[model samples]
Structures are given as structure tokens and as C-alpha cells.
Target: MSESDPHQSGRGRVTAPARPSGKGGGKGVGEMIAIYDTTLRDGSQSESVQFSVEDKLRIARRLDLLGVDYIEGGWPGANPKDEAFFARAKDLKLERSRLVAFGSTRRAKVKAEDDTVLNALLAAGTGVITIFGKSWPLHVTRALGIAPAENLELIFDSIRHLKARTDQVFFDAEHFFDGFKADPDYAVKALMAARDGGADGLILCDTNGGSLPGEIAAIMRQIALPDVRLGIHCHNDGGLAVANTLAAVECGATQVQGTINGLGERCGNADLTTVVANLLLKMGRHARLGVEGLPRLTGVSRFVDEMCNRSPQKNQPFVGASAFAHKAGVHVAAILKDPVTYEHIDPEQVGNERRILVSEQAGRSNLVHKFREMGILDVDPNDPRLQDLLNELKELEFRGYQFDAAEASFELRVRKALGQLPEYFLEQGFRVIDNRMVRDDGAWIMGAEATVKLVVGGQPVHFVGEGNGPVDALYTVLRRALEWHYPAINTVTLVDYKVRILPQALGGRSGTGSMVRVLIEWRDEERSWGTVGVSEHIIAASYAAIMDALIFKLYKDGATPAV
Candidate 1:
């Protein structure tokens, strides 16, 4: 590290003409800004996000379908799982993406040909290879304990060595942004070393994730190198990875390296989810992401989350559940009239839909919109019943019911108010018993039994079920009691059950007596829906949610409507 200025914005400097965004070059509207996905490598580095080899393969398949240009699988020999991934990925047969193998430049004392790291990269059997090397003078001197010149040789030798054996090679200038600020001349030299070594592209990394957009644009303008073929790899520690990447693009950088949902170590990497949408929709630029790929953005986002065993972020931009939801009465009314009034692009363009939430803030327009969405087509803005429905919705919301996440229950309520719902079955009450006993080994065994009596098709039915808990027992017995009458109920299963203690429901009671809210996600082969119930007793709350789910399923499956 040498000359530095934390406040220096690289302003007024002329930037070189932009190169083709991908190695397969083209310019203008037809040219694509290659999307380089590192989710299998970098995203797996996220805290608590460990992808199995199978998970990596699944994600790679999905990314290929989405038409990303490059997929960096992982460092092959860095770990056993990555090794397995590459071996398994050999048969992956990606249609749209070229598989990439990642590694570092040769170690300080090692020759490029003999370096175990480089050998492992070649062994991965990928068509493309990307290697990172120190760019900062301080890192060259301290981190590598070598002269700056020797480090340059290491980078050049590593790339040239791989280039002779492989088709294409890329150099990731680690800490390039920070290094440029410290010693602008040395950082540029690092990229030059890779270029001279026959590297296809030079990736500038904001390793510290602290660089601002102004700094990125300004620094990019300072790079006067020819045949730059630049790429930008940003991290999100400063909450500016997406912004910085876009800035670099504005200054002529082509390829963008990031992970899905911004998953990575520490704060995270640039979110390809936001980057892709902005590139195609906002900037009106092109990418290798296919013609139909843009609409599948939300599906890809959620699919990655599912593979990571993480829940989808509702408030995430573009593809989030709440991105298109309008709750304010004024906003909903305007959006209903013309989505352009409140939305940036059509939600369907990104594989999402608009939601008009019915709550205390809602008005006639919200109820009318929501009722129609639930198939109550007769709802009118001027109808008195719309007002009554709105009042009931508010009252229910006041009692701790959230309709947005639990739409099945909300749909059922709307149908009932519209006289479109008929009683499919009647509950004749239920009983649950809990038992615990100590075994000879001093271990305690626990069991719960529930007896449910329901009158279905005017016939009384009784069933007893056992489970590890009262709620499970109740659901088992109740679902069993209904399956005989409604055979379609057999496909319905409880996929997820969530319980929350709402102190506000008990007027600010935070103790054990606080009312509980239960939300259960039910799914069949076709689709899934969420149902909710709130009660002072957990068991009762569970029962209410379970019953609502069954009722909703039966109703949708052609249970006779009221005469």
C-alpha cells in the first residue's frame, strides 16, 4: 500500500470504452452483460448456509435454466464437498452456463506447474478457471511476505500456466479496489500482469465491501488499460454491493459476479436477484438470462432459499412476497386502477402477483379488490355488504389475525360473508389426554391421545389418534375423521406449523396466559395455502387452524355451496 485518499472520488477522469460484457463478445442492445453466479462457491460461505453436494447440483441446474453465463462451482480440492460437487457436476450438462472452477494464484514459493492448488483446479475438469491474487502492495509485502514484483510474477505465471492447459482463464484481483486507493499504479499493474499472461478477463474485487459508488465509478475511469475485459465482484458489507456493481457497469465494466439472494460470508455478496432485475428491467440492458428467464426470477430466488434451508425474505426487493402487496387504501386504489401508479414494473414480469391486503387501513376499494381476488366476483364498490366485510376484516385483524400470510383463512371468511360457503361438516367437540410415565431405565415416555367426533354428510363419525403432542394428535384424529367423507383430503398434509404468542391479544399479557396464534401451511400436489387461528389455549388455536385448512381444502375441492 502507498498513496491513499479515503475521500478521493475519481472524478473528471475519462473512462475507456466498454468491452463486451461477456467473453463471447457483442456490443449494444444485443450484447449481454454476462451474469457470473458464485452461489455454489460464495453463497455456501454464508453463515449457517451449507449446501450439500446434491444441493449444489440442484442449484446449478436451476441457474443453467435461468440462463446465467457462468456458474463458479467451488474450489474443487478446498473441501470434500466441493470435490464431490465438481465430480458430480461433470454430468450436469448445463445448457446455458459454462461451469467455472475457482482457486488462488500459485503460492509464494511454488511454481505454477507444480502448485498443488493449480493442479486441483485443473483436476476439477471445468472449461473455465478463475484465480485470485493479492493486488495491494501491503498484502504483497505482508500477506505474501514477498516483493511486489514476485507477486506479479506469481499471478502471471498462474494464469499462463492454466491457459496453456485450459480454454479460458480469469484473474480476480483480490482487494483491487482497496489496493488501487493505496497504490493505484501497483493495482493496475496487477491487472496488466494477468492480461499479459493471457488471462481472458480481469475481475476487480471490493473485498472489504467498503467502497462507495462514487469511488467505484471514479476508480474505474482511472483504469486506462487496453483489452481490459473487466468484471466486478462486490460484497455487501457497506450495503452498496449492488450499487457499486451498477456504478462499475456505468463506467464500462462488463461481467458482474454475485450470488443468489446475496448469500456469502459476513454481510453477503451482491445479490444477483436484484442485479439481474435492474440490469434487464431498469437499465434495459441485455443478459444471457433467457427470454423467459426474467419471469422465473422469483422462482429461482425462492428455490435457492429452499435449497439453503432458509425461509424466503418477504421484504426482499423485486421477488419478495411483499414487493407487490399494497396495503394502504390510497395505494391499493391507485394500483388497482393502473399498476404504474405505484409499481415500477408489472409483477408478472418477475413471476410475482399483486396483493391487495384487507386490514384496518383498507377501504371499499381494498375489500372489492380482495374479494374479487378470492373469486367473490359479485363484490361491488358501492355494495353495503363490502362495508360490512371491511368492518369484519378490521375486527378480526384487531384480534391478532393477519390475512396476508394466511390467505386460506381470509378466503374462507370472504366466501362465508358472500353466502358462497356451505357447511361441509360439523364439529361435535373433541377431547385430548396427555400421559407421561417413567421407564425402568429412568427415561420418561410421553404420549398424547385425541378423540374427535364430527358429523359429516349428516352421519356421526368418531376417531381416536395418538401423537407426541396434543396438536398433532388432534390433527391426526380430525383429518382421519374427514378423509372418509372427502377423499380429496388424503392428499392434504401439514407441511409447516408456526405458533406465536401474541401478548397484545391478551391486552398486553406477556405471561404464559398470553393468547397464541397458530399458522399452518397445508399443501396438496397442485398447490399450498396457509391458514391461521388465534386462541387463549394453544391446543384450541391449533385445532382452529387445522379445521380452517381442512375446510378451505374441502371448499375448493367442490364441497357443495349453499343453496
Candidate 2:
């Protein structure tokens, strides 16, 4: 089969099935549930989420590649950024998913054709348009300040007008669940209005996100729309967004609207990654993304998080780093024999891997498994060296060295013990001087200067450098001194630096005297790795971590001294 074949399955590849041809008419009309992604729209509502026009376009392309059925770009009429995104999106050439423009229904006091919002939706130049309208009577009576009948007319007119401009018009019945609880008849009336007005699908939205799975399923069954397709949009306020979405699917909803990693306002929207996994693995439903797209789920999740400049949640469901990690002795032993003994599914199915974590909680079995996995040792479980390594690891953890977050440092320690580590350079000593003064431009500046002395090939070398801070200055001098011997060090960059103060009870007296743990993440062109250090002085701890990072990079690159 060709790479573009929609049925292919593999790692880091998605095979988007053909789009469904028909609209929602009744239960079981279509076996596939449309994965409508709102990551660019609702996801931007997350705190600290700010996507530029380029970011949105990049995400849209990624979602399309992930085989989602629809990608909701943004509210084109809301801001110039969104307008520019739509303008750029027109040239995206998405293969399977339809690009959608989101907006609210026309204002109650205006004609649909004359509404600037609807006009912008048309101007977005997408084939699909989604508009949210008030479903709750309270929103109509208080928020809109319009009569119930007038609200229904607004829903009808808005969808009808958009249907003329586009073949696909999805009506979002905002607060549908809450609206049904407050006034069932009126909520049903709103849905019916959208259905009668030629909406391709009527999405029941839990805007407040307080509805339970049972309540959502019950309400979905009660909604008697046989001709219109039903879609579900839920939030994570109640921590049941995925549950409620699944419940709706079970009750015959055919479309699922959600954001990647559940990014949204307040709690979040439904996490489409979780939704897709559950549907394909548990519910036995067919998706356009298909089982082929499952392996790329974790990659897509991390990619979205990276674009948002957020760390991937290590404990988040199937895709998390710790999802399949075993730390206990008994668990590791059982999993090594048969992973199904503990794991629900194969981690590789989602492009994740089983990891045996070495910690104080780990035992002989855990150590053996971790050693084998790390390619460090494959000796007997009762080997004395294994026990020694475990003891040393525990002692390091007691000193605030977190191997879990800094595996590279842990590996180096193991190599040193095995007498396999090459001494890249001998550090004689280093000194840093900080000077605080006002600049000529009246700006306050803290200048940091550092002098580093190192021995390479039995020859002493001294280097001096300046930076904005002590750590920066130290790294600058070190890099300048080492580049002559290890040119590959230039390719390695410190991508992130984190520090934490160990609790007084752990081992410290007061604020400045407290022991600090530093974790530095380094990335080269090929890969990224983290190293950790712990010491009483913050600068000392940072220096240790920085040295470990450089040594790890050199070791990985096989850098040797010049002749």
C-alpha cells in the first residue's frame, strides 16, 4: 500500500480513513464517530496558552495528520490573529479533516445575513462552520434578555443562514445538559430548531461541565432526534469529561468534540487522545484515525504540549512516561514474566514503552529488570553488584538525586562504578564574581564573571568569561575551555534548568543553608537528556549538574582528546 493509503498502520504514522459521506439521521447510521478537534479554538482558553498565527497553522496541520475528522481553527471574527490564521489556513491543503470556523449564532437583534460574525464565518472560506447558541432558558431570559420563542428563532435563523453558505453546519447547543435540567422542553426546542434549520449535526455541549455520565447518557436517550446527527462536547470541571463523552457515544452520539490533552477554560475540555483510545480499544468503535493512528497518540500529545511550552504530564493515562513504569520488586518480576500481569495494554501500541524505575522502593527484581533495560547488566538477580548498585542508588536518592528525572546522570554514575567512563577533563577549580551596578542607560545590571581552570591531556588551561548570572558565566567559561578538545560540546545546549530546595527534615537548617537539587536538561541535534546534582550551595549543585550534562554529551558522542 502507498504511504498515503488511509488504512496503513505503523509507528509515527497516521492513516486517516475516508470522511463519512452522510449526515446524522438516526442511531447506527454511521459506525464511525467523528473526532472534531477544538485545540486551536477552545484549547487557547487555557491559562498560559498563547498560540501565534503560525502556531495555530502548525497545530491544524498536525491534527489533520492525526486523522481528526474536523479541525476547528478559531473564531475568525473575534481577533485579527484568528482572521490571519484562517487566511493562512485556506492554503493548508488538509487531506481528510475538514477545516471548521467557529463562531456564535447571529445576535438576537440582528439579521443572520447582516451579522458580522456570520459574515466572518463565510469569509473564513472553510467548508464547515460551527456556531454555538444558547440552549439554556436562563441564558436566553437573562443573558440574551430575549423571550424563549425569540431565542429559538435566533437558533433557527443562524443555522439556516449558514447552511446556505456551506454544506456542513454544526450547531453547538451550549449548556445543553444544564438547559435540559432547568427546562427540558425548551432545550429540546432549541435542538429541534437547529435540526429544522438544516444543521448537519447538533452538538450537545456541557458548558458548565458539571453533568455526570449517567445524567448525560440519560439525557441523550431522551433527546428524540432521529434525523439529525448528535455530537457531544464536554468540559472537565467535574473530571468526567471523557466519561461523559464515552457515555454519550454509548447512547448513540456519533461525533466527539474535544481538545488535545484536554486544554481549555477552567478544568479543560475532553481529552481527545483519551477519548480516541477508549473508543478504539474498549468501545470497539471504528474511527477515521483507525487503529493505525494509535501508536502516534503519545507523540501527538507531547507535540501539542511542546508547542504550548508545557511539560508533558508524566502520569497522564496511556501516553504518560510513568503509565507503564514498574518500581516495586514483585510488580517488576511479574511484568518481566508477563507484562499483561500488570499492564492493561501493550505500551508500544501507543508508542510508549515499559520502564522499570530504580528507587528506594525498588527491590532485587526491580534492579535486575532496570539493569537489563538500561543495557548495564544482565546478571543474575542475586548478583552482589546488582545489590551494590541498588544500595548506591538508594543512597543517592536520599541525597536528593532523582534518577527518574535525570536518567543520564544515573547512567553516568553506573558507568563510573563499572570503570567504563572516560575522564573527559579534570576540573582544577572555578571562581565566580558578581558585580551589581547601574548602567550608563540608567538600567540596573548584575554582571557575573567566572574563571575556570581545567587539565586536558596533562596540560593546564585557564579560561575567563562573563554572563548575566553566575551559572551562565560558569557554563560560558567551561564551554570555551572544552570546545578545543570536544568540538561536539558546541552542539549541546542547556534547554532547561530547574532547582528545588530539599525539606529541612531531609537535611538542612535554614533558608540559604538549605540543600538544593538541580536538574539540567541538555539537547543536541539527535536527542535530549537530563542530569541532576545536589549540594548545600545552589551554585555548587548547578555546577555539578552542568558538568554531568557536558560529560554525558561527550560520552554519547565518543569525543576524544586531540592529538
Candidate 3:
């Protein structure tokens, strides 16, 4: 079948089937709930996550603007930075969000008034106070070296005393799950003590983060209470933080606490992104948290990742890089017809765009998707000529060219493969040499020699230049050569460069064909783009990638290539 046939027919070529009718769950839309972000306090517990005083205030304001219900700044009295944060936060006009100061209960023998820790909490000037007390008998008797009855007194005195200073008080039963397993009666009594002391909510903390979802549900069912709001704060040591939170909710918890992107100590905290997405779309309910701001979720996630200098997990449920990416021919075809077939939720809802990956596993649907993104629709799906193009893509991907990682280069290649790319300068030959010298002043001077011959608009240009490195020298020579021949050709810059070595599994063997991946970036007044080059030799790979990027930029600017 010729590729032009489908285009000529103007009928359905590929698309998804109609969604099943009458399958919608009733009234699962527009729910109002609070987003309590602890990225400052709890998130800092992540290995090596220490925010400066400025960082803490900046993050707190951002979270406030993002409309989170509460911001857990930090343990007020624990450190100087946290103390400074509390003092600074006092004057900020953070409307619609409350600042919750976190700390543990007072010592076993001290009056809450005289307790330095409780005093610090009051001085923080926060309306809400969250205090954790030892709930597990083992912790009370062994860790704190106090009798279980005395530990109960500590829980009561702390909450009751804090209640006098703050209108809202929450009791965190630390290690509530494990404590329940050890002594169910004592665990229930611990929560009861907090309630009796006028606490607003009983937060059952899975402090060790080792409990399973099924176990969480069973225990929650056992501790079902009718008096106050039941909350769940789960850690991710077992990699089930979200799962346990959901299980707790299903078993009857009113409030859920999690850090955005699951940023907490040990493995991490439950991810509110995943939990809210699942609850809204999968569970078919107005997620306890509203989904109206879903579009801002990705940007918010990125903002925090950047602040923490941590990369977002690529496969993170709704906000990950690969969340809406489609690859395999069948999958791409399905998605093209109907995105809902494979996608659980529309990416636009989460401020993420869908991507069609082109590789060995790709189909012509990938080509169509790419073309569409570039504003070229109505592609011929059954063109026989395009079959060879798909085959070429497969061959290149097999040779270690990954379009998924190097999208800029892939776009240029796609145009070239389709005979739509314009040529600028035809390089006849190029050579580069590198040299270094140690100066008498204890400094090293590195240099490069580059020679290039190129034809631009039927005129021949030869140029030689020196630079700090061989790649730079070659680039200087090429730019000089092009500029000498065609003054209209724009200058290019290498904003970023990356090199990767492909390792073979045969006894840690190294080969002459060690793969190198190079990414070159460029910018103009309007926009910027990154292109990739892959080859066995590092220099050659960089040159190949850089040339492709320059050529593509020229073509995009309506400059014709020199033959």
C-alpha cells in the first residue's frame, strides 16, 4: 500500500475506539480539600536536604501561593535557621494558608509552661501546633525509659497545655502502626488520650514506614473512631507510602498528610501528586483535594525539585517525564486514535504535554505525531516511500542513536530523511589538533588548531582557527568558513555538552567503538533548541551533532543548504 493512498482516500486510517458509554461514576468532580505541604520540615529529612533560612521562607511563600492549606515550616526550636523562619513568617501576608509549627511533647516531668520546647512553640506565633508523642509502649519503656502510664501522662499534658496557647492542636501518635501491632489497647488509648486532651485530629504515624497496605487497612479498621478527624501520615520505607495512605482513607480516615513528590526521610513520604491523581481519576471521586489546579502541578513539582537540587523521578506517577510518553507502534497508534485508551488522565490536566517517542520500537504514527507538533498535519500514512524512512529510523536506533534523549537532533534528522531539510554549508574536509603548555606562572595554556573547507551558495570557503579545545577549534573553523562564504548564516553557540560511554557486559570489555552522546544547545532572540550527536569517537560525535544543530537552525531560518 502506497503511503499516498491514505492521504488521497481522506478516510479514517488509525484512531481509538469510542469510550464506553454510561461508565462514569456520578458526582466525582469538584471536591474541596486542603493541601498541607511539609516539603520544608519533613522534606528536609531527605538525605542531605538542608535548606538555608532564605530557602525555607521562599519555599513557604511558594507553597502558600500554590494554595496549600498548611506549611510545616520546621521544628521551631530545633535549629537556628528554623527559628529564623518562624520569626520571619510572622509578618508575611500569606492569606488562605496557615503555618503549622511542629515539635514533640514536653519532657515527662516538666510543666508545659516551663518546658523550653513548649515555650519555643508559643513564641513561633503559629495558630496551629502539631506535637508528636511516643505511642508505642516499646518506645515509652525502652526508647524513652519511661513507664507506659507516665508516657500517657506526657501525651495528655502536652496537648492540653498546647491547647491553651493555640486554638488548633493535633496529636501525632508516633509509630502508631507498630505500636498497635505490639499493644492494640495501648495504641488506642494513646489516641484516646490526645482526644481527651482536646486535640483536633489524631494523626496515626507509620513512623518506621515498614507497614503494608493491607495491614494498614486492617489496623485502621481496628482503630476506627467516631469522635475526631482521623489522619494518616505514612513514610515510604516499604515503597508503599501512597498505597498505605489510600488504604487508610478507604478504611475511613478523613485527613491525609503527604509531602509533594514524596520528599521525606528514609525512602520518602507519600506522594500527594500520585494520591490526588489516582483518587480523582481512578477512584472516580472528587479527590479530597481539588483537581482544578492540576495543570499547575507539574510546574510546582519542578520548582521544588530545582530548589532541592534533586531531579524528579522520571516515572513518578502523574508528574514524571515519561508519564504521558507513547512509544511502541501499537501504543502510538492507539493513542493517536484516542488518548484515553492508554493514558489514565489527560496530561494537559497536570500541566504536562504528551510525547511520541521515535525509535526502533516506533511506528509511522510517531512520524505523524512529530510532524503534527511541528505544525505539519495531513501526512500520508500509507506512503510506500515512507516505509524506507521507518526502516532507516530502526537502523539508526539500533546503531545507538536514541531520539528519546536527543529530540533536537532527531527533529533535524527527520527533516533530512524526508528530504525537507535545507542545506547551508557543504564541508569538503575538516581537521583539528589539540596542544597544551605549562606557563612559568603556574598556569596551563591549552590550544587547538582547526582547518576546514566548505562551499556556501556555490562559493568555496576555506578557514583555519585556534581555540581552547579540539572541538572548539573545529567549531571556530566551521563558523569562520561559513561566515566568510555566506554572511547571512547565523552564528551558533554550544550552551551545553554531554558525553556518555556505552558499556558492554562482556567481562567489562572496552571497544574501539565506544559510543559517545553529545548534546549541543543554541539560542536566538526568539527561541532556543538542543541537538544531539552520537558516534564512536568523542570528537567526531560532537562535530556530527553540532553540524546537525547548525544546519537545522539555518533551515528553520529559511536559509538554503549549499550543495
TM-score of each: 0.91, 0.90, 0.87
lDDT of 2 by residue, 1-563 (tens): 13332111112111122222344333452478899999999999999999999988888888888899999999987999998999988899899789999999899789888999999999898989999999898999999999887887888889989998887999999999999899777787788778778899999999999999999977776665556788999999999999999998987789999999999999999999899989988888989999898898898899999899999999989898999988877898898899999999998888788998878888888866656666866467666766788889898888788888898998887777666788888989999999899989999989899999999877899999998999999999899999988887888888899999897876766688888899999899999999998999888899999999899988888877442
Itemize residue pairs with steric clashes in candidate 2. Answer: none
Worst lDDT 10-window in candidate 2: 6-15
**Residue 334 Cα positional deviation in candidate 1, in Å, after optimal superposition:** 1.0
Clashing pairs in model 1, backbone N/Cα/C closer than 3 A: 1-138
Model 2, residue 364: displacement in angstroms? 3.7
Task: Give per-residue CA lDDT, model 3, range 392-412, as digits (tens).
Answer: 878776666677767778777
Q: Write the per-residue lDDT of candidate 1 for residues 1-563, one digit (tens) a residue.
A: 11232112222122443433433222444446889999999989999998999999999999998899999999979989989999999999899999999999999888877999999999988979999999899999998899987787888789889999999999999999999999887787788778778898889999989999999988887776554578899999999999999888776677999999999999999999999899888886788785479898899999999998989999899999999989999998898889999999899988888888878888788887877776667556687777788899888778787888898998888888877888988889999999898989999999899999888878888899999889878888887888777778888889998988896644646688887889999998888999999887888888889989988888888866221
Please list the residue runs of candidate 1 whose C-alpha ends up more than 4 Å from where it truly belongs after superposition: 1-31, 290-292, 453-464, 505-508, 560-563
Best candidate according to TM-score: 1
Models ranked on TM-score? 1, 2, 3
For model 3, what is the error of residue 264's alpha carbon versus the real structure, in angstroms, after optimal superposition?
1.6
Evaluate model 3: give its lDDT: 0.76
